[model samples]
Target: MSNSLEILQKYWNHDAFRTPQEEIIASVLAAKDTFGLMPTGGGKSITFQVPAMMMEGICLVISPLVALMKDQVENLQNKGIKAICLTGGISSDEIIDLLDNCEFGNYKFLYLSPERLQNDWILERIKNLPINLIAIDEAHCVSQWGNDFRPAYLKIVKLKEYFPKVPFLALTASATKRVQEDIVKLLQLDNPAVFTKSFARENLAYMVFNVEDKLHLMEQILKKNPQPSIIYVNNRKSCSETVTQLESLGFSATYYHGGLSPKDKENHMKLWMNEKVQTIVATNAFGMGIDKANVKTVIHLHIPPNLENYYQEAGRAGRNGEKAFAVLLTNPSDVIHVEAQFLSVLSDKAFLNLVYIKICNYFRIAYGEGIDEKFSFNINHFCTKYSLPILKVYNALQFLDRQGIINLSQEFTEKITLQFIIPSKEVIRYMSLNKQDEEVILTILRTSPGIYESQSVINISLIAKKSNTDENKVLAILHKLNEKGVIELHAKNNDATLTFNEVREDERTINRVAKYLEAQNKLKTDQLKSVLHYIKEEKKCKNKLLLSYFGEVINEDCGVCSYCISKNKTKTDTSTLSEKIIGLLKIQDLNSRDVVKLTKYSKDDVIFVLKNLLENDTIMVKPNNLYSLKN
Candidate 1:
């Protein structure tokens, strides 16, 4: 085998790199600042991994998600690459020790979250490592112009300042042209070449299902695409509730979200990755850096916040190059729910000032001085007490953070409730009269909030396991009873998640701030419009559209998109895919480039045939960076 093929076989055990991968790898190895606009499952990690293995020094990869960092490090170690990450769960002393290992130890890849970049000891920790390349995953987060702008990303500029000779490789599955430019400018890359691969997935069908009952809908979708799948819900409550429903239906599944204990999240995720579990019902927080290539489908329990989010979540399916499907389940009310959320974000300056005051009053302390005291907040209760809009209040809090008022650490807590308010006999009579509804009635009573003085902290799992029902049923039945006005629903200490801009702007400042907020609101609305555009785009192949969104322009169609497939069905008549391969290669080599080179045939035809050949072991990509006939 030739050098590239030997490296491929030795480490990744693949026949050859995907299209554009060779060029990308070559650029990075040559010490050029490289930007890769590859689609989901396009081997973006491999581009950096190969170069990291080839280079003599360590490659520092800055990622936003800790779970993604952990998974990638484990996967690399599994492949015999030395890798590690310094995340928050560890102590500072442990961090010092880990840094010791990295500095003198035989480690090639070191991953760190951008937040850690600002840590006082981090620069001290890595002041002397033989670092070579700096790979920034989720590069869009660096740009304020993108959907998830993280201020921590700005700290990455320190990399170039600290180590001027190190090359940079920024990789992201989804980004807009503006975000790509921002990443390049932010990272201070000196004239980087963006290698973009097509985003079209012919094997993964894009479809949506409208369902009133999400639990029933989840089971139906799971049964259809039974292979390992991911089900994304908007909240942690929904994630756990859906997992319970899936488990009740006898599908072994798990759940993950920012809400779960880190240990629980880690254990449950391992089960799915290890194939001990077949499904994971989770919030959008799950599934980054997940490289399980055989995921069959991804079901969105509700509409995603934006097309960028939806596309990234959906793209998780069919990664093994096999046929897969991605479906979205939407209810009409979902739009209203989302709109309500967005509108609530428009809290007036008074609400912000009021909440800021309450926050200060609650702490009996002002901002910049509460580092030692822990805060637990329920926006609903807080707003109710203050007669403020919860959504607007929430936005005020975020804006305050933007204004440098408070520190909102990433922490979540569970809420529990008691079921009925009536006496036992009265409840018995109600159940007796509605004998057919006993199970449903019992569910409402048991899962009902307020057992502790008619209210308990959130403990749906304990209730469900005891009552032999799932959280979804518990919630659904409770809603049914509440609809009939049988009992009231009261929650307490809701959603402990909090963020603080370092200082609260006083109420006296609102009239002066109104004009500025109006402009910010318009900017936010425009961002939402861009999100809608990503969703409604149907003209270009999905892959090409996604790549171009990241500012990488592929001159030819991917030939492997769903649109290409449907078109090929109507236009071409062939007995075998080999004939199609020959037709494609007649115009060019059978490399990933040749597959991408054709402007004539549908990309769906080219990719579908390529997959078939790979599966049957008919055609093989060999050494010397070329494809050839094999028997």
Candidate 2:
């Protein structure tokens, strides 16, 4: 009864633990290093969460995302388990109270970002606290090879050095072979037991549509299956736009993104989870750490950053062992736009230096002095003070962070600059097109440094004021320069930041390291999109496509995916999976999750398969899924 199976049944009502879950959870309980490679919706959190509940001491979970931490903590609390999260967006006093509660309370779990580990004040108190185990979420980010690598998350591995007796568990939804090795090595796991569940989803179909009328297509698809759904878009603007369109068609939909205020975000999430909202349109920011089971469908308005991202996003649907749909709406032209958006973060050396200079001037902090200061930025104010094009300036600021020139925290500041190349005499060429054009150009230039000097990183907004011109007009001119190559344009490459072990090198060495990384990063970007292209191709089963691409071969096709559905477009499945039937189910009668495990399939493959099986009467689900051999 105390083993993994009983644990799954008593507190949680599942009949059996999946292939990797028992092994992974057992390793954690036995005080051994563990690595788990479960695809999304693989019940990954439960593997750690259940064992943590049984352990004597608190399971300190190190997570990279603050929002994800909060979500996990909230879920545990809802289950009537004890948990707390430490993060900066909340008050310091509240954190102190929470830690204090943990010190004496029955706190079974403590969720936090790795950045919290660097807080000396918190570390002093936490060092004495008895930690039974440690779990790292999104463990792949610990690796430089991972798509969204973070320097801070890498610190989780060093926790072993501190609490060497406690076991470590690293969990991730997706990671390439290289990324997996890096995660294990970086964490310094000692011959850790690796648990890899099959990465196939047999019931959910894989689909890629090349269409011009994405919105119209989305409407048609929604019509085909009216159920609880999610619509994923790439940007906040698109989230709002999609939600509006969905609502216009009488679908009760809501939108979620980073731009929404915290209260509004919470409200929107509650609505979605409660089934009050039939569809939720959102960006990649929406689904992390959200566990709304029974999501009937997931639609992507734009192609995702990579296959890992897309797989995870699509996996959100059909968590309840029911049939679900995942669709991607894309156009060929979208490739150019997505590529540009990604490459915007990777800037030339000169552009990076410009940003570092601007950041220093914006905060009025000298180099090496702005390590951890807090500032909230105003883009309009920044544009006016620097007279720089707001877009390029924004991109450059991001690049500075990428270059490790400055720490762009969850904070922002307002300052601006204008280059002096287009002198007043020559500025007349672009002027009079707008009333504030000439004055705006002069003002921005005055507040900021000249683009020609390359050393004068100035504030654009303040300069706009000095020259008595419009910030918008100033931004227009700066964009014009970037367009005209009047000055070098800067942009952000991807969502990745550096992950260093320590600051062993000095400033010069850091620059050398960054430049090397910059080059390697470019190579990674150049090859990443091709992986996504494979996912979109119509040639193979989605899961097989990924495995073959990664050099992992499967002998048989998982006859349940977008490709399979199209090939067998004659039938539709309606039977739902159940637990009782699953328990009575022996070899020939596998429910969705069982088939997934038995076949060693991915989420996409399994979903597609179950849908096909149900349609063909290849599998039958009675009440409680007592799937007696069906033919």
Candidate 3:
């Protein structure tokens, strides 16, 4: 066998692999199927990358996220490994050509989405390729028990049938015992070697604070930690609002959500990643594939629906093994509010059916038509046209996606492009005539490469910087230029595209998927209850509670968490209580029982304090057992 260490050093510049990475790589290299259950930052990618480089043929990776596939492909190519990812919007001819190159060319890695595997042509072509190993990232998605399960993952089993000799490496960051067993069974691995690193992060402290004002609590936490952090909210409006609120408190903050354009998202991400900003207030779409290692804290402004979601998002902190905190700031009402919002939409059968019909109409698909057709959809437009609630519509769309009736993906495209319509002399002549237009035109020309030759993608923020203005100004100038026939500009758009995976059969199709949707709703409710239970649990060790939820056992309490801190504070203050009782008696006499009831101390502690006070002549008990200070 080829040396994996040499391959790793030559490509990645890493001298050693983290625990179980080397072990997992060795198992795959020895022609054994393996399952790696590592934490969020556990170096799972290198397990396949290093082994695939040392082996002979191509490594086929089936992933679900287009962004993740794109990032990993670019990273591998930068390391001098030939890699390609086949995703949506690519033509059939382009995919065929790419696969043909992979078959003949010495390509080390082929990353493609799971939906791509369902394509008959792609599957047939893949059968002819020289495949050595198969890696399934996010393997838990194959099981219905997982939070992010996708039906497309079920198609992965077909690869094993085609190449019986090839070994499969299934990996997920977080999965329970049930999900792990399901992954092994669903992938049909033959006695695979399993590697499960515990989900416990000893460096991370988990805390939950019930407060009246969540924002106030958040500000306090940020003030103390005051490092690179992520504040996760549930909606786009909340994301922006939180950022605004934080900035009003004199903290450098930015915001991100799925609704932002590609350029805007990139700009905000760079600001946070480069440490130009202290905190990034974002929706759930913020953290995948983001590699900032020094995130000191991750605070959730609202409760997540499941432990898996919380674990993954909170786990983003302290990746560099420093002491960090994951705190959830919520109130009693938040639990009821979140549950009501989700269940109202998710559990409504009639509402979901209406949404399904409306979606078909929105896409102009008649009954029993539009199978496997993709359409660019705007949720706002659909909701406004039908007068439906936006959140409910979104939930229904998600239900369709989980049911395999449709594939909905949000595409944040770099659509900022410009093609000059007027000649260079006219532009200069017009610029000389109009002083207001001169700066914007010059900024565009300087920032965009090949703007004169053809349409080019431009960054609005970079143009703003060069023009000494803002993004709104840059965009306004672009729009004015387009109107004046000086340029044809296409502004950036952040919209979701929906593809009909099956024909629009109306009620029959909805009924077919109704059972699965019902089960999903039940699971979600149970998941929410479990998180609520964790938040309300007081006496249990926070770390031990979380570990036990993920099917692990730990004996000791995490000493630094809020629960332990409070517990310890009460343990070492027996003398302080006596002094407080004597001082209170000096102000006014009170019985021992009344003192215990009125004060926050326990009855036994108050009684102990009264006994010590009487022994030291600090207080005296009258005939009626009323304690009085000595004269």
Best by lDDT: 3
Q: Write the residue-wise lDDT of candidate 2 on 95-202 in tens digits.
A: 788888888997989888777777678777777677998889889877776766666665566577679888889998888888889988999988999988766676
Higher-scoring candidate on lDDT, 1 or 2:
1
Give me the runs in candidate 3 sitting further than 4 Å from their true place. Answer: 347-349, 412-492, 571-631
| Model 3, span 301-365: residue lDDT tens | 88888998899899999998999999988754575477777676664677888998989988799
lDDT of each: 0.68, 0.67, 0.83
Candidate 1 deviant stretches above 4 angstroms = 1-15, 74-84, 89-97, 119-121, 209-221, 243-254, 270-278, 346-411, 415-524, 527-631
The positional error of residue 550 in candidate 2, measured at the CA in angstroms, is 5.2
Per-residue lDDT for 233-328 in model 1, tens only? 877767756776778898998888865667777899999988798898888778776778899988887767566677788989988879887776
Clash pairs detected, candidate 3: none
* Residue 551 error, candidate 1, Å: 6.9
So what's the TM-score on candidate 3? Answer: 0.78
How much is the lDDT of residue 77 in candidate 1? Answer: 91
Mind sharing the TM-score for model 1?
Answer: 0.66
lDDT of 2: 0.67
**In model 2, which regions exceed 4 Å deviation?**
1-19, 89-101, 104-106, 119-124, 383-520, 535-538, 549-551, 559-631
